[model samples]
Target: HMTVISAREELVAFYERRGYRRTGVLTPFPYDDERFGLPQRPGLAFELLIKPLV
Candidate 1:
């Protein structure tokens, strides 16, 4: 299982403290076209985070 958050570096660090690690960033994102008729915002991307359950 994995969780990811597309946010600032500080936010990623915050998740890191909670056992989440920075795997990578999401490659393809439809930032140009509006999905669901929603407005577009900058830095609105996806990041990959993973945490191992033990």
Candidate 2:
């Protein structure tokens, strides 16, 4: 159960301020393969932020 957010890095800090913790997981996105998606770009990677309910 999770939601993925993708966009310009300018919003990185914005999310962090809201209590989203930066995750250690990152992956190089395959720009040419349809396995990922239709749109592709250079230096594109996935960043994860998680918040857990206690």
The sequence of per-residue lDDT tens digits that candidate 2 reaches over residues 1-54 is: 122434555676677677777775776666878877776446776667787666
* True-structure RMSD for candidate 2: 3.3
Q: What stretches of model 1 exceed 4 Å from their correct place? A: 1-7, 33-44
TM-score of each: 0.56, 0.57
Clashing pairs in 1: none
lDDT of 1 by residue, 1-54 (tens): 344446567888888899888877574455666662453555556688888887
The lDDT of each candidate is 0.66, 0.63
Instruction: Give the residue spans of candidate 2 off by over 4 A.
Output: 1-7, 33-41
Total clashing pairs in model 2: 0
Error of 2 at 46 (Å): 0.7
lDDT of 2 at 20: 75
lDDT of 1 at 36: 29
Ten residues in sequence with the least summed lDDT for candidate 2: 1-10
